[model samples]
Target: MRFSSRVNAGAMNPIAAQAAAAKAAGHPLGQLNDSNPTHHGLAPQFLPEAYTADPRGPLGARQAIADFINASRGRGVDSANAPAAPAVDPSNLYVLSSTSEAYAWLAMLLCNPGEAILMPKPGYPLIESICNLTATRAIPYQQFFDGSWALDLASIENALREGNGSVKAIAVINPNNPTGAYTKLGERQRLVELAKRYDAAIIADEVFYDFTLEPFDGNARWAGEQGVLTFSLDGFSKMLAAPHAKVGWIEVSGPAEDVAQAERHLDMISDDFLPMSNLIADCIPAMLQEAATQTERVAARVRGNMAELHRLLDADKQSGDGVVDVLRSEGGWNVLLRFPSSIDENALGLRLAHDFHMNCQPGYYFDMQSNGFLSISLLPEPTQFERNVQIILEAVHRELA
Candidate 1:
């Protein structure tokens, strides 16, 4: 039995690295490290009504899921007689404990050892680890940022043309994590076309899809209608502010023919893990029924926190210490605040914890080489977020200046 080298010696997952380092120092981390909701207090939203609802209750989880599938948005689970859920069928949607677990199944289903996929750098830290954990390769592309993040399409084109064409998938974090910028609608179209041209598939991790700070709502994207295939990932973790529920899903949307093939493969993979815990998987239906009300409330809190953050940053943007530009996001609970590269982020992160008692994430964690990219969660109540932001801003100002 031989082990692959990439899996053994690539950059370690940053979240895990931070946890280990924290435990080593005897100061459990402040935990701005992982995107899990438990850190930010989203566990309250994740409580499954089914947990309290009786097994004999007519409208408990099992029925709620059935009704939600029959509803318009849950097109993924339409009928049991059908081989796969219609995009509208609730049953077609498969939830995972975390997007990381979703990544595991996806990697195993798509790649063989030694095969690769083009992932964007300065992006999600889990992207590569997921591949490595599953014994596959994550070759990276650049998500360029001078001020706002943008795709370096030329590099993508070159990689696609230059490679031996072994790559079978490409991932884009729409309204990317760490970056917090939406994939431009025009760019989204181009991505679909690119996947088709390369004979590859798209995996859009849109966990942050509902957290838009933008004025307008992004569209309900469906790749199945287009000639290309895509697996759009999202879950209660972000949608319902319920990370404690451990509900995440991979949506198969693409051209009918390709989707059929993709589904055949994905269903087998999902079934292998079969009977996703009855608890949260059971909550999906009730969650959907109450989505309209719950989503609005969550969105309001997130929107308020985002607005407050901007007000503080904007008021001091012209100060002598220099300005920090916060990335404007369309959908997601986080923002990327970029600062002077002169100051080290990891050092600053440590200082924020020890000196200011505030926790913030460094940019490098996301494979972002540029320093001063800090990630913060919007789950904190308005007052807590406001206080923490000031601590970070003041620290960066004092340390860097």
Candidate 2:
């Protein structure tokens, strides 16, 4: 019996296999790559009534989301000079089961089989997996790092030019996973211009939008951007620490005609799946209203972890050659640490797991170009995170010695 090639391509990823093995072995793996908020004790509390509410997710839920986004935008705007940003239209939003589903729908909406979409390199591998499932091609453009990660716009142009007009969309993970750098205003403008030049759509995965470490002065939300068709994706998973709830959304915007047409197509696609669960959907308003408290808890944890990491690095530098150098992250749940050039990341990960009983994501898992980089989560329990960092430092030092 012949099977579809796309199905074959969707095999279990290596990192997942490693994690599963550790779990099955009953090892107390010091998880330093966890992204699920539930694992970090940040689960959202829902009202009892939400459980038996309408099976169709309530309209109030979408309105709550629209209100949340607009408030967020207002906060980001400079009150002294900038005009109040327009509120996001609730009608423009479509609920989904996960960001993965949002991407899948967008893939179907934009690409025919074998067509291409541009993705950022040193980014999450989920995009490739989604593309594989949809029979679309994922073309990666580079994000170069100096002091901070920045888009290589030239590389993006090159991908589009050489794509032979098959590139249908550009996907941006704002405050990208692992790297944690937000897209600057100039970068966004250029991206819109490029999309217009190529007649392509933009997909901004702003799941980590609320986790910015620095002050945001520009328009932080992407749902109201003009000139190019855009789909800004976010969800309760990250915002409310409710991944188990499985609620996400796509906010569509552009020229009125374009947005209207896209909404129609999206409506049909979403209706066919009817992905979101009513319980979580009905709880959206309360979850969002209480989001700031939950967010502050996460932010505090991340900041504490970051501060400790920097202190450790500084101590190492004071003693001798530093064993690990942490790249600066503007926002996100993970931090990237670069070790000695001689070490292989995969071997380092294995050593950390077997010898240190700790597990971390190797940089290569995120398409990082180098061998010495390791990505560790900032979302782990505080005490465990500090202990893990010490173990990692000691192990690296012993290796270098």
Candidate 3:
């Protein structure tokens, strides 16, 4: 895959190369220029004795992530119907503070000024915000819904045609935030072909892949995709439901030459910022050990709440003051509640917040094309979620009345 000109194209310097060789030889050469207080016999109890600066992040942490991902991939798949997931390599992974940071790094790695990245409409605003911060254009491609959300391939194709090689990447959110729709197998194949044809990379955010609600058959992850260059992102925040964990990573895969070049540029970009902290890197192994249990715990919460929502909506349907539909959700913690179109989403959002003392995000917040849609999280405790649904139904009913 072609990278942006902003990336550092220079080769490794002599000093760093020598240091790498020395380290590989297992010779712990004392650094005359070592500036770390811990290495100099200060704060020995609080800090690591020495810093091992691997620009892709600490080797042990990356390996732990790789193992966890490889194991997790097969756990959810039915091997009888699908091919085995390709093995993940620690060298191909880059640990960062969050998926948001990974997005920024990718934006820099792929886009030059005035170049573009295609983003899904009715998607999270974070992608567009990152584009604006990096001076990259965010071209919107449609994700329309009939019974389920599907990508508008024509829209994406047109954007690539219009970009004329100026498009650097195509960003896809698996099981998209509010929509909760996973990219199907056929869709994935077409997307790979599109990226290959346009000479663009694919940036897939699969943080919500594990929380399957009502996914279609043959749904799968974008990581380890070999058809074209792809960067797959996931993090502890979503996997463990611990936002404070503040850990995320990107796994790069594609044609060998493209992967190598992308990694070289990414290493320089990561070294420039040195974003991952040694302290957090040290905790990754322990954190990963707890990931599967936490994932199951959180998955149960979301699935239960989704069922509660359906029960409440079904039981309350006879009231007839207004109708609210829970749009088909395949995966992810949130779902779109489509209310009566006569009520504007903005006004309803305000009413829920100001008068009802309920905080909610309106559909417009995600750039949904129409009104009267509210995005609701399925993460609350069961009784509280039931109560919240009742309140929402009452509010909509009152507005319609």
TM-score, predicted candidate 1 vs. hidden true structure: 0.75
Give, for candidate 2, the lowest lDDT window spanning 10 residues: 1-10
Better of 2 and 3 by TM-score: 3
The segments of candidate 1 whose C-alpha lies over 4 angstroms from its true place after superposition are: 1-87, 90-92, 215-225, 277-280, 317-322
User: With candidate 2 superimposed using the best TM-score fit, by how many Å does residue 40's alpha carbon deviate from the native?
Assistant: 44
Model 3 Cα lDDT, one tens digit per residue, 142-256: 9999999999999999999999999989999998998999998888999999999999999999999999998888888899888999999999999989999999999999999
Q: For model 3, what is the error of residue 153's alpha carbon versus the real structure, in angstroms, after optimal superposition? A: 0.5
Q: After superposition, how far is residue 48 of candidate 2 from its true place, in Å?
A: 15
Q: Candidate 2 on 1-401: residue-level lDDT in tens?
A: 11122222244599867876887799746768766465555656653233312222456788788888777657335567655445678887877778899999888878878988899999999999999999999999999899888899999999888887789899999889889888888889899999888878899999887776543456355667767889989887887777786788888888778787677566556656654665657677877877788887888888888888898789988998677999888888888998987987777777788888887888889999878888888888888888888888887876676
Best candidate according to lDDT: 3
Q: Compute the lDDT of residue 11 as modeled in candidate 2.
A: 42
For this target, which candidate reaches the highest TM-score against the unseen true structure?
3
How many pairs of residues collide in model 1? Answer: 19
TM-score of 3: 0.94
In angstroms, give how far residue 18 of model 3 lies from its true place: 6.7
**Full candidate order by TM-score, most accurate first:** 3, 2, 1
